[model samples]
Every structure is written in structure tokens, then in C-alpha cells.
Target chain A: MTDIQININNKTYPTATQPSIANLKLSLNSNEFICLVGPSGCGKTTLLNIIAGLDNDYDGEILVGQQHTHPKIGYIFQNPRLLPWRTVRENIELVLGEHQSPDVIDALLEVMQLTQAQQVYPERLSLGMSRRVSIIRAFAIDPEVLLMDEPFVSLDAPTARQVRELLVKLWQQRPHTVLFVTHDLREAIALADRLIFLSASPMQAVSEIIVPIARSDRGNELAIESFRQQLLQNHPEIKQLL
Target chain B: MINLKRFLSTLSLLVFLGIWQGVAVYLNSNTLPTPEAVAKVFWLGCVSGQLPFHLGVTLLRLVVSFSVAMLLGCAIGIVLGRNKKLDAFFDNWLVIFLNIPALVTIILCYVWFGLVESAAILAVVINKLPNVIVTIREGTRALDQDLLDMARCYHFGKRKTLIHVIWPQLHPFVMGATRSGLALIWKIILVVELLGRSNGMGYQLHLFFQLFDVASILAYTVAFVAVIQLIELLILKPLDKKALRWRR
Candidate 1:
């Protein structure tokens, strides 16, 4: 487990004259779940893209530390982007290659209740199933820093909860830095160890607050609702921004 | 289900043969031979190995031209599809080539390169290349960016990404090109051979036509059509089934 430091000097989308991300500095402790909650179109995904090394146009440098020079990254986009032609198992095995044993896939599939669906192509899988397959794909890599950008947005509540539980289980099984992005504040409170609220205009982290509830109690709807109401009441600024 | 499909296919072919037989009988002329006469000629040609030889020659030409066109078209198409400026510049060139008549290309190739085997193959390849490039270009343009991002994030590298991600997405387009390539090339090869080549199915058919040997021409036509059907059954169909089993 290693802390990751991200320093974004600036980022200006070519189409837009003004910078979307400007001088945003963020630090993530090792083995911590950090949720980046923000308004819609706040460039949260772009920040994740920069961190995952997908977008090179951003003026930023992520320091993954000296001990581990080449840290592995796993990303889950807003949509389930599994290859339509690859089966669930093959999609997971794509990340493994010659690096890890096939047993990890088997174990993860078994845990995620996707063992039966492993041989099925992505098209045959329902939306919920496809989302689960993608989640398995991300965790199967055993990534050093997993960046998820609103993976649970379109899913129904029960399915989303199931997926969230599975994600938490996977995170508990491994020690890695997770940077989850979402627009929903309750979801952030339930999943994130520390919540980082992002402002829409300048697109930078505005405030950081620790989740007061324990991991076990996150499943309680009343507890989560009460916490959400109290946080919004205490900080009227965060409420409007959210 | 497979057995039923095969049965229906056999029935349709039988009905076709019956219709041809009826038509030829009604005509009762040297220009339209009966099925029995054509079948006898076909049998004799096969026993003597003349039909097989000409067929082998034409098949070799088709294979060569098809391979070259597909390879070059896929490469060029991928390049143009990825680069917008290059695609825009070459866009009109593709349209021009696509619109040019096959007869003109064949005649031009023979005139410029002389009546040689290479010229015949080049003429066929040039005729077929643009269609392949266009189909594959559309596929390349339609490639899912999200899947590509997934591949990049997973560190699949260039080779793995191509095989697993890019290739599968392009499979339909490649197959479309191949099937159409086979159909279009076989027909164009006949024209090319008729125009220039000394030996091939087309050359033999030309000889039969000049002699007014309707039975022999029909015999050779039957043999040619049978071979193409065999290729579809033995090679293309199985390949298609295997490659697209993942698709709904």
C-alpha cells in the first residue's frame, strides 16, 4: 500500500478557451476509499482520465511514489464498456495475461456470483450483469489505483447496492487506493472513507470530509439518510454545490 | 434444424435443374442444350481433366488477387480511417476509382502491362480494392473508443489490443469484404481472362462460344458454379459461424 499524490498544474480543453481544471492538488492515503462527489459535467471524469494515463493532454503529473515506479491502474467508465465479442471470463483474463494465475479469475467470479455467466458474451448479459462483469474485470487486475467514474449511475437501486457491496468486498480483499467519482452525495457517504466535494466552475476539490459512519452500518437506509440531511444542514454551501 | 435447412437447399437446387431442363426442351435448338446433353459434356470434360485444369487456373488467379486486395485495402483503410486529413484528401480518389468501370480497368491494364498473367491479376485487384477499402474504412471509423480505453488501461499493448479488441470489432467488415471479394473477383477474373489470358475457365468458355458449343459452355458454367458453392459451404460458412458465435 502506497499513498498517491496528484498535482494538476492546469488543463484547458481545446474547444474551450478557459481551463477546466486549474491548480488542483490532491493526495490519497494508501488503502483508503475516496469518493469525488461533484455536480454533473464537473470534469471529474477528465481528472480520472488524467490519473489513469488515458489523457496526455492534461497538464498534470501523478506521483505514484519511488518504490513502485510503474503502478498498475484500473478504470471503470460511466457505462459498462466490456468488449461485445469477449466472454465475461475472457474479459477478466484480458487484464491477467501472463502476469497472474487463472485462479484469481475463478475466485473472483465465484465471489461475485458470475461463475455461471463467465462463458457468456457481453451482449447476452443484462445491464446489471454487464456492470458486474466490468467490475470483476477491474478488480481481477488487482490494480494499485482503481479509478471508477460513476459506474453505478444507470443501475436500479437494488442492483446498485449489490454492486456496491461486491465492490466493497473486493476492496477489502485487496489493499489499493480507490478514487471513485459520483454526482450522488448519499452514494458517496455510503461508499467513501473520505468524501472530496468538487466544485463545477473551476473543477477542483473544494472540501474533504471523513465519513463518520462505520462500514458495517452503511447498508442502513435511515442512518445514511440522517447523515445526508445533517451534512447538508450543517454546510449550506455544500448543499447548493451538490 | 441443420438437416431441415440442408433438405430445403437440396430441394431448391433440384427445382432449379427441373426448370432449366423444361426450358431447354421447349427451345429445342443448338443454342439451348438439354440438361442431359450438358451433363454428358460435363462428365466428359471432367474425365478428360480439361474443366479441372481451367478451373484450377481461374481459382489461382482469384486467390492471388483477393489476398492482395484485402491486405492492401485493410492496411490503407485503417490508415485513412485513423487520420482525418489523409482520409479527406484521398476521399475523392476512392470515389473515382469506385466509379470507374471494370471493363475500362481490364482493357487499360492489358494495354499498359501487355497481355500477361500479372496484368490480369492486377486488373482484378484494382477492380476489387476500393470496395474492400470502403467497407473496412467504415468499420475502422465505427470502432468503440470506450473499449479501446479499457484495453489501454489494462495494458493489453498494441498486439493484444489488436487481436482481442480491434480485430473482433472489425471482423464483420473483413468478412463482408471477403465474401463480396470472392463473388466480385471470380466474375471479374472471367472478364480479365476473356480479355487477355491464354488459359483459364474464361478462355475455354470463349473458345466454346466461338465454336457455338452450347453444351460445353453450359458444362463449364455448371462446374464453375459448383466449385464456388463448395467454397461457400466448406470454408466461408464454417469460418463465419466460428468467428461470430459471440454475437447475438
Candidate 2:
């Protein structure tokens, strides 16, 4: 928490007639995996987009450390959004931006367990495989902060659970500041060091719950459920939304 | 080990030829030659070197015209596809050219440029360019915006985005243009050559028509049709397969 990496101060986004996010304030520290949990249309995705610099039409001071400019962001969308013509390997290598070595790509593919699907195009890949590739593609660029928007929403339960565990493990090793967005409370409880839950339309920071469970405690279902129960008790609004 | 489907298709073709021969026999028509009569004239023409000379001339005209059309079409299509302003500017021009009859354009080319070889080829090129441009521009417009955003976020510069993203979408469109352009331009080239030029398969057909040699005309038509089918099978199909391997 001491190594503050990114700060968003009083960010307000106007879309159509309503403000998408109003007076939003949040800061992410280095190597901390923060989960943004909220109901549908909660501006969780919108906030993540702002941090990624995808939508710049917002009133805010988004600073990387003390700098006024936005940091280089790596984004993993809900849908993989992989190039259909490019093979899985080529898709991942795309993020390398021509300066990276073949070895770097090989290592990343190996980490993501996508070595076999290297020659396969995105359309050929299953939902889980494509999502894994998408995540690795985002991570490969070595971004300052990784922004994921319900990246595992399409996967089945078991696959999602496995991926969630793998993601935390990956974070533990390489340790980039992560802002993961999802609607699943169990998922939020499992991966998040701190979880920020937002209400429905015209969303604000409704509540922030710090999960006392360590990253190592992830994948222990009983511990995870207990943590979820504790969070529900502590944050009554989040409980009511669920 | 005889494949019934293959055997039946072949039998159908033979039966159709027999029926045509029967029609020729019944009508005793000078204009509509029988299969055997056409075969004889075709063999004779080939043996006498006349067919080869005319075939070469036709091939040359097609190659020239198709090449010009491909170059012009690809350049214009890509520009119109990528640039909105250019697309808007050229929208009416494309519509006008596309609607104008090929024969009308051919006559205009003849009137404008005289009986020159370039004139005939230019006619074919102009005839095919509009359709190619429209197809490719539509494909370019249908390109996925998400992939573009992904490339932007990764800071993939112009060259990389083009090669990786834009090219994949454009490749299919280009292949489509090539197929349609080749198909259309070849036939149009033949028409222009037959009407205006002194040499080519079309010119030979015209000469045969003057002599009332129906067999020779049939032979030339069959020969040209075979050439087109061969190009489709040998070149375009294989290229299409390679280009669209990702689809599989």
C-alpha cells in the first residue's frame, strides 16, 4: 500500500444525459490485485476504461505516481477480441511490439499454457483458451497496471475457478498492479486484496471491503465462503445487491 | 471402384452433347454445328497452327486487360475503403460507371480512342473496376473496431496494425476482387477483341461467322470456356484455399 502506483482523483464522466461516474476517487498500489465488484451498469468497467486511457473524456486527475499523464495500460476485455486471422502465438506476439525476442513470446505462451494452440487461430480456440491467451497478451507488454473487465465472464465455473487461481499466482510472481472488474462476489472475495463495490446506474464508490484473507488463501473454498460471508455482514449494501 | 456421382455427371455431359448433335442433325443448320463437326474443325485449327496463334493473341489481350484492371481496382478500392472523404467523393462516380453497360463503354472507348489495342484492354479494365472497388470498400468498412482499439492500446504503430489487423480483413476482399475481376474482365476483353481487334479468339470467331463456319465458332467458344475453367481450378481455387486457410 505504501508504493502507490496509480491515483484517480474526482473523476467525472458525462455520457448522454447522466454522469457515468461522479467524483470517483481510487488509488492502486504496486503488486496489489484490487477487484472492482458491482451490479450491471455500475461504472466498474467505465472506471477501468478510464484508467486504461480508452475513454479520455472524463474530468479527473488520473496520475501515474505524481505525473499528470496517464501511464501505459494493458487491457483485457470480456471478449478476447483477438485478431481472427492471427494464430494464438501471433496474437500474443502482437503485444511485443516488434522489439521483443522470440524467447519472450515462448516463455509467455508457456506460462499461459498456450503452447499447443500456438498455430491455431482465435476462432478455433475454445472460450477458456481464448480468454487465457487474451490475458497473457495483456500481461506480455509488461504494463504498469493491468485492467481486466469481467475477463472470465464467459467461462464455465470450474474453468473460471482454475483461471482465477492461476491469475493470483501469476500476480504473486510478476506482481503488477491489477484492477480486475467482475460481478461475481465469490470471485471478488477470492482474488481481491481490497474490493470496491458500486451500485447500479450513475455509480459511485458504495463500499470498499478489505479482504483479510491472504493471496495464498485463494482456492480454499471454505475460507473463501467465510470471507464472502464476512464481507456481506460488513457491507450491507453489497449483500442487498447480491 | 467406380464413383457413381462422378460417372453420372460425366454421363450427363455426354448426353447433353449427343442432344446438341441430334438438334444439329434435325435442323441441318449451318449456324449450329454438331459436336463431331466442331471437334474436327477444332483439331484442324490446332494442327494448322491457326488456333494457337488466335489463342495466344486472346491470352495476351486478357493478361494485359486483367493486369491493368487489377492494379487500378486494388489501388482505388483500398483508398476508397480506408478514407471516408475519398469514398464520399467517388460514390457517384462509382455508381455511374457501374450502371453504364459494358458494351456501351466499349463503343465509347472505340469512338474515343479508335481501334487501338490499348483501347480494347482499357475498355475491359474500366468495365470491371467499379464492382471491385465497391466490394472491397464494403469489406474495409465492416472491419472490427474492437481490434483497432486493442492495437491502439498496445501502441502498435501504423505498420504493425496494418500487417496484423487491417491486412487480414482486406485479404479476403482482395481475393474476392481478383476472382470477380478476372471472371468479368476476361469475358469483356473477348467481346471488345471480337468486335474491334484484328486478332484473338473473338476475332477468329467473327471470321468464322462471316464464312458461316458454325463448327469453328463452337470450337472457339469451347476453347475459351475451357481456359476460364482451367484458370478457376488451377489458379483461383488454390489461391482462395491458401488465403482462407484461417477459416478452416
Candidate 3:
């Protein structure tokens, strides 16, 4: 099993008045889906950046597997950052380069329901369609680890639900470690195998909840509500966030 | 609709010429020749081949100087925009070059290089380079860092990042530099040619001036302006439309 270890001693910006993250430690097992729940501005994105190796200002060490080499990371930002000049298909193909086959891209376009829009540029796409393209881009890389920073935050309920279900299906097809950051407690409960809750600014993990239910069973509305209620009872502070 | 636009443009040009002809007739001075006289002289020069040869020389100088300035300026501007320390160090130098008058630079180059062709092109480049650098530097500074982060996360190599991520963003700025550079450099080259080298449109204009031939001077001016407009319409406009087709 691939084990990932994260040890963040502290991270602060030169202009900031306080550290963004302090003494934050976590680990992940192979193919485990973890959700990080935190209040807004709790440095969740910062933590993701650190893990993605996008930010090196932090005092931390992220050890992925035994060799400590970084795993191939797929990141989906809140807004789809597709290149405006590139068509939807090209944007996905950009990350895969020559390694991806034509059939794989065709399959992905079909699965994402973007077959008709494959040739369209990003500017012509609707918000939901654009985000799907972004998701397609992230998955096209076949990343060993996926980091999603509130991928469904601003989306309408129906679109968000669609994307969430699509994400689950893709993950099941090819299981990989996923660290999803979202403030939506219900969404966290529904998707994550384990949920890590962080306190406000200068974030540190305050609680961890392991969902005993299987992924398929967790989709039921009753089960998700019961899990949310149980979580609020155990960690009352999380109730305020919800 | 396109035909309407073409018709309106031609009508506007006709009106401008009519007004110019009216004023020239009223003045009845050799200095302000009528449009017809200038056109006649222009046709004669075209037939004699002097006008085309001199225009070619001036066009060559313009192309060479413009390419050199743009290449060097874009490289320097991007580096300055990316590096804060370097930008700070060179900020004063940029200001100094920008403030130096175009005439002063032209005269200084001619004097130092002894009226050579290189000196003439160098003078034009010096006049145009600072403006290109400033425009491109601002574009580089305004680049979206979020997109850059996305590129990095995707593991796009340096080459891909430059071509796909960076170049598209910088293109508008490059176009801005090119248009303004062409406008300014052509004018400076004329002055350089008038002051120094002897084979360009500017040198011919100086000859016309000595002979008090207002018709020949006006003919040269019209011919050069037409050539510049043709280059803009045929080359630059199409490139701009194609490169920025995504904006539509």
C-alpha cells in the first residue's frame, strides 16, 4: 500500500500577521478518499498548495510512498482554469501529452457528456460545461493523487450533484488517493471515507471522523443526514460551521 | 453590410481629397499643390522607378530596425517583469532612455557612426525600443498567476508552458508594441534618412525640398502613406484577427 505522510511545522506569509497553518500533521493510505472540512480562510487551499508542491514557502515535508518522490498530482480548482485559446479536448489532452490514446479521450468526453463540446473553446462553454472540462483535464493525467479545492463550491445544486456523482464513478473505475477540501459537511459525509475537520485561521486538525458506511450505502439521504447529526453531536463546534 | 462599409470608406476619402483640392486651388501656391498635380507627379515617379526603389530602401530599414527592437525589447521586458530585483535596478535606466528625445538619439548615432546605414537603423531602433519594452513589461506584469499555477500543477514542461500558457497572454501586448513601434519607427527612419543616408524616401524628400518641388514631395508622402496602410490592412489586421479569434 502507498502511504503518504504530511508534516507541516508552520507556514506563514511575509505580509501576513500570523501563521496560516501550524503543526498540521496527517497521513493517507492507498486509494483512501479523505475530505478536509474547514471554515473559510482556514488555509485549506494553502495546505493543498503545499501538498501539490506549488508553494514551497511552508516549513513542511510531504513524504509520498517510501522514496519520498512526489506522486503525479491532479488538481481541480474552484473555477475551471482551462486555457481560453484551447478547445475543450485540447485542454484535456494538454496534460496527457502523447501518453493518452485517442480512444481514452473519446471515452472521457462521452463519460463527461462533452462529446458535442469537444471542439468548442472555453469562452463558449457554460459554467457547468467548463468545470466538467477541468475535471476531465485532471483525470486525463491518471494522477496517483488528486487534490480538489472546493471543486463544486459555486455551482448550482443540480450541476454540483452531477459533477459529484461523475467524480465518484471515475474514482471507482480507477481508484486513487483523493484529498477533497470543502466546507459542505453533507457533501463531505457523502463522498469521503474519512473527514478531517480544521479550526479557523492558523488551521490545525481538530477532529477526524471515519465513515463506517460503504461508499454505495453512504449515498442514501437518510444515511448522510444520520452521519451529519452524529458528527454534530460528537464535535459540537462543527455544528456552528454547518 | 461589408459592402456598405467599403462604400462609406471610399466616399470619406473622396470628400477629404475634394476639400484638399479646394484649399489648394484657393491658395494658388506652388507649395500647396492640388491633389491632381500630386497624383500626376506620383504616376511619373512610379514610371521612372526612382519612387519604388527609394520606398523599398526605406521599407527595408523599417523592417530591420523594427524586428531588432521588438525581439530585444520583449526579451528584456519579460525578464524585468518576472524579476523584481532586476526591474528595480533597471527602472531608472528605462526612464532615462524613454526621456531622451528621438531627434537627439538620431543625431548622436549619425555623428558617432559617421552617417552609416547601421547608424541610421540603430537610431530608429533606439527611438522605438523603450516604448516596446514598457508596453510588454506591463503585459508581463499583468499575467494571471492563477493560470500559471494551474500550468505548474498539470506538470506542463517549460516549453509547453511558454507556448500554451504564456505566449497567448503576451500576444496582445506584442501586437500593441508592434503597431506603435511601426508607427513611431517609420517616422524616425524618415528623419534619420533625411539627416544622413542618401537612398531612402526621406533622402528623396530632401532632394525635392532643395529643388522647391512641392509636387514631388507630396507624391512621395502619399506613396509612403499608401504603402503603410496596405501593410496594415493586408498583414497586421489579418494576423490580429486570427490570433485573437478566441475573444469572439
Q: Name the best candidate (by TM-score).
A: 3
The candidate that wins on lDDT is 3
| Predictions' DockQ, in order | 0.82, 0.68, 0.82
Candidate 1: tens digits of C-alpha lDDT, residues B94-148? 9999999999999999999999999999999999999999999999999999888
After superposing candidate 3, which stretches have Cα over 4 Å from the reference? A98-103
What do the candidate models score in CA lDDT, each in turn? Answer: 0.88, 0.81, 0.89
TM-score rank, highest first? 3, 1, 2
TM-score of each: 0.93, 0.89, 0.97
Which digits, one per residue and each the tens of the lDDT, describe model 3 over residues A1-242? 54888889999999999899999999888899999998888889989998888998988788877666667899989888999998888888888867567677887788888999999989999888888888888888888788999999888999989888888887888788899999999999889999999987689988888988787786698989997888788789776554
Weakest 10 consecutive residues of candidate 1 chain A by summed lDDT: A62-71
**lDDT, candidate 1, A36-76, per-residue tens:** 98899889988988888888897767777744233588788
Compose the digit string of candidate 2's lDDT tens values, residues A1-242. Answer: 43434334434544367666776667777777888887777677778777777777776677666777777788989888998878888887878856767676677677777888899988888898888888888878888888899988978898987777667666676789888888888888888888887766566777887888866677788998987887778767787555
Task: Candidate 2: list runs displaced more than 4 Å.
Answer: A1-15, A56-61, A66-70, A240-242, B1-5, B82-85, B170-172
Which lDDT value does model 3 have at A163? 85
Model 3 TM-score, all chains together = 0.97
**Candidate 2 backbone collisions, by pair:** none
Higher-ranked by TM-score: 1 or 2: 1
Per-residue lDDT value at A96 in model 1: 88
